[model samples]
Target: MSTPDIVLTRIDNRLVHGQVGVVWTSAIGANLLLVANDAAAKDELQQELMTATAETAGVGIRFWTLDKTISTIHKASARQHIFLVVKTPADVLTLVKGGVPITEVNVGNMHYSDGKEQISKKVYMDQADKDAINGLIDAGVKVYIKDVPEDKEQVLQKF
Candidate 1:
């Protein structure tokens, strides 16, 4: 199996919005947007919405369950440049553990919720989120927080 060229892997709660569909996709030169989220995959409406957004951005999009993504990602065409996006750090960690060659992760937008601490202006995390990110770092993944391509990359240190 040959894996597609993964240009960028990002953790953004808002799966395929303007920043992701237009800015990050264009910046990374990814022809395909692979959204690996279990909930999004099962939600037909969300898939349709995200697909529309990706189409407007002129990029192909796929919403797959984490299991499917892990099993089938390597089967993608080698010519395909994939930009993998997921909702959380734990998802990223799952993909990595499942044999996705994700060396670096861009922490984009993790919204505030109960029990979640504000790690940065645009990021909030609870204990599990922090542990997942820390695990990624320990696995030699270069995890950084950057909302957009133009923003400065903030390397995440284990907390």
Candidate 2:
């Protein structure tokens, strides 16, 4: 099968669960799912878990480390539709810092953490998270919050 068009979404929880596999994918018509996370890609257990979750989505899923993902997306020889997802603000930052070509970011689900303050009912941002997100904004990448397909998307600056 060929790679599909990528719909980039930034979800902080690290797992591409229900809202992602079913809701977002269906809405965006994603056929190839790319979940970029170092720990999960390197760990057999986590990979297995992610694989299991992906199997139910009726989409081709690939787990990639930051570097591999960046290269894949950057390659001129490679072209396929992809639903690109990264789990953290840091991952987004990493890609930007590495000069990965990105224009937009969509927040899906970022769970509550000790230092994380709720930016919205479905979103939260720690100071560093804010800075990282803002950095993406500074670099001209659009950042928005939408926990699921049906939720309203708010620009990160509004937070």
Candidate 3:
């Protein structure tokens, strides 16, 4: 049987970090990992950067860009059990605006930058960021914020 399409699409800046390697991977029972971002895609040298980081406990990785990701999702394919991930909520928002087929959005860890204010214990979402997230949710995307596997999954609406 062909595997399903993207099962989870998360918005976590630290894409292949601790949470991905340990919690999310097992919690979802997913094997394939795909990270889409411009810098990681265009840099070429940085290709497989996420792989080295994501291969902690034996996992496959594919890194794509915004344009590439959009194209791939549109053309259906029999993929392995893949959990697609993006770095920012804005990127997720952009995907929605581009009419991507992403339904579930998880906010893992959005670190605090200069202008970003801490919205929750594990989240640091700014107003514009909040607006983008809300737009996606309003457009019918199920957005959840959960830092680790053990932690409770809090819906982004609670923010």
Would you estimate the TM-scores of all the predictions? 0.98, 0.87, 0.86
**Which one wins by lDDT: 2 or 3?**
3
Q: State, as a TM-score between 0 and 1, how close model 2 is to the true structure.
A: 0.87
After superposition, candidate 3 runs with Cα above 4 Å error: 1-4, 44-46
Give the best candidate by TM-score: 1
How many clashes show up per model? 0, 8, 0
Model 2 lDDT-worst window of ten: 1-10
Better of 2 and 3 by TM-score: 2
Q: What TM-score does model 1 achieve against the real structure? A: 0.98
Error of 2 at 148 (Å): 1.6
* Per-model CA lDDT versus the true structure: 0.94, 0.75, 0.77
Q: Write down the TM-score for model 3.
A: 0.86
Candidate 3 C-alpha lDDT tens digits along 34-119: 78887777665555566666687466777778887776765545646677888888888887887777888988889998889987
Q: Which ten residues in a row have the lowest lDDT in candidate 3?
A: 73-82
State the local distance difference test value for candidate 1: 0.94
lDDT of 1 by residue, 1-159 (tens): 886699999999998888899888999899999999999999999988888889988999999999999999999997789999999999999999999989999999999999999999999999999999999999999999998788899999998
